[model samples]
Target: MTTDNRSTLFSPLTLPTPDGTGFALRNRTILSPMCQYAVDRQDGVATDWHLQHYGAVAAGGFGLLTIESTGVNAAGRISPRDLGMYNETQEAAHRRLVSFIHSQGAAAAVQLNHAGGRASGKPWLPGTHGGSAPLEDGGWQTVGMTDQSIAKGYRPTTKLSKDGIEQIVSDFAAAARRADAAGYDVIQIHAAHGYLLHQSLSPLTNTRDDKYGGTEENRFRLTREVVDAVRAAWPDSKPLGIRISATDWVAGGLDVDVTSRLMRDLVKNHGINWVDVSSGGLVSTPLQPSGPGFHAVLGAQIKRALADTDAVVSVVGGISSPEQAETMLRTGQVDAVSIGRAAMRNPHWPAMAAARLGVPCEDNPAAPQYWRAEW
Candidate 1:
């Protein structure tokens, strides 16, 4: 979306997409992926809750909408109820979701992930089964790419063998193909938030001695391979993005500078279209900012650092206002601002902002059959 000083975050910005697809930001606003913990246990199917949640978000007019984290392997799940794309039934359910979102004129993307050692845990709630559980609680032994020691309630995983590594890559590629077949517009390889891929990226967690560990290059190898494999399986016309923890937010963890270089490589070397910037989630706990637009500055810094690279930067976290989102885009700091908790609280936020800013509302027009007199 084009904008000037008075854009107020409602302006449209044309984002550069990957080969073969058109992925323009309808506006500078997006509905960031947030795990809804909604899945059917009987068959790993997406229930009415999933449909209504995503359908409303599409109707809200966000430029791009990503489905919540979905596991590529059974043990990769964060919670038992988390969605999966490892099977045909799950793929069918996702196809229905994609159809619903496209009907609203918004793009649909899915974040494929592996929970790593964090899998087989209880629901994310206070005093309610935090961390990985024991076998008795229906938690099978968790695994990772290395033999690094794990904390309490979590078991150290058997390091993935050469064949296992190949299998993991295949799993990601298969999932990407499924996403495409299911009618998804964009495909995101989840390498952030201390998940399987991020675990491989962080030196703090990946302590392997082979080609996949020790040095930063080795540490980044697995993630890069996954990116390459997913891109190969996914159609070149569609945009492929990766969400990364720009900073682990720990003193000893990966720094933003190194990650900035990595982003450049992904863009310049591998032709990645965008880097969805997020932070922390490396360890059980890490330092993080509490103020609004906390991650915006980091995203801006990354954007400036990669001025020579073709990758567009997108920032998440603490973005709650139309004005703030607009300012970020107008200043040329971030290509797009994504809303997480805020969008969850108010699904019509995009439509409301469009009305306030006097921009067109082509993305979210409520059907007359549903809300004619109310409008």
Candidate 2:
């Protein structure tokens, strides 16, 4: 058999959005978005810490580097330190960061998110949740599908009205413009992990009868609208993707089947490029599974379900070893492997993985280092 050096984890992946936007990654490894919450000014600007953090991961050799979940609006921030895209100052800050990622030959993506009912103060700090933070202490009134408190020790949330819903769509579009201006190559709409979009998608949290709730179609309306808006604003030459909770881990909640279908529809009508699948976190679910590559099965099902489409699905959660990553990709469990906490724990994981999988790190395109970028 002919030997292609781009074997297993080092294989290239190309995804073209339904609207003609595309990104050809040198490998199937993607740096999953993980919030830093490192901005201390409460202004949502990128800091030197962000530069070092993402810079490390970028140099670690992932084909695509997705920045953390950034707030589309100040009021939608999960913490005061979360990155934001609603202002030029924030956009300018990200430009330098994105430049660094690109200088390393990695495609840069930004995850646009709204915390919804979960918005508040420091998540790492104690005494905060659905009922704790006062408005003056860097916490604003949070909004979601309903005004009911998600839980104790968290900010009580206000229900989003029709105008509020429209505003969210506009906000996402505005964020796309800013991301484009900042030189981000992709925009990953964060609709998963019990955030604003997931809060509305999962029936466990959304109990409204309005057009934006009740039926799955209604619950998916907001996310779909945001996708359409972002697609219009983002460049057609660059890919657009969304990160979604494939399963709520509760009976009668949004599951892989529903998520796969929703993603399919997005590809068919909304110009979606790729899907990053992670499960749970919508509500307190005791049934959530935990283990190595625990969520790959659901992501695999989504990938199988979309076999006819150009859309791709990336799986995250509990994936650390290069063998696991290679196996998942070889078996078609996922189009790409995304790493979160593992990447942070070891920014050199990709290069290390390349070595383990028999792809010489020195020769792998994914392992190339542009020290000039560092200079």
* Best model number under TM-score: 2
lDDT of 1 at 292: 86
User: Given candidate 2, what's the lDDT at residue 304?
Assistant: 87
Compose the digit string of candidate 1's lDDT tens values, residues 32-124. Answer: 888777675724568889999999888777777888888888888877778888899899999999999888867788989888777777665
lDDT of 2 by residue, 1-375 (tens): 114445567877897855453678878889999888799799999999999999988888889999998999998887887999999999999999999988877889999998888777557565433343576767777888898876656766889999998998899999999999999988999999888898888888888899989998898888899999999998888889999899888898898889888999998788898999898887776799988998988888989888898887899999998888888887777889999889999887777787777775454544344423221
Q: Model 2 reaches what TM-score against the true structure?
A: 0.94
Measured with C-alpha atoms, the lDDT of residue 179 in candidate 1 is 91
Candidate-wise lDDT, in order: 0.78, 0.85
What is the TM-score of candidate 1? 0.92
Model 1 accuracy (lDDT, Cα) = 0.78
TM for every model, in the order presented, reads 0.92, 0.94
**Candidate 2 pairs with clashing backbones:** 129-153, 129-154, 130-153, 130-154, 130-155, 131-153, 131-154, 131-155, 132-153
- In candidate 1, which residue pairs get closer than 3 Å at backbone N, Cα or C atoms, i.e. clash? 1-12, 1-13, 2-12, 9-326, 20-237, 21-237
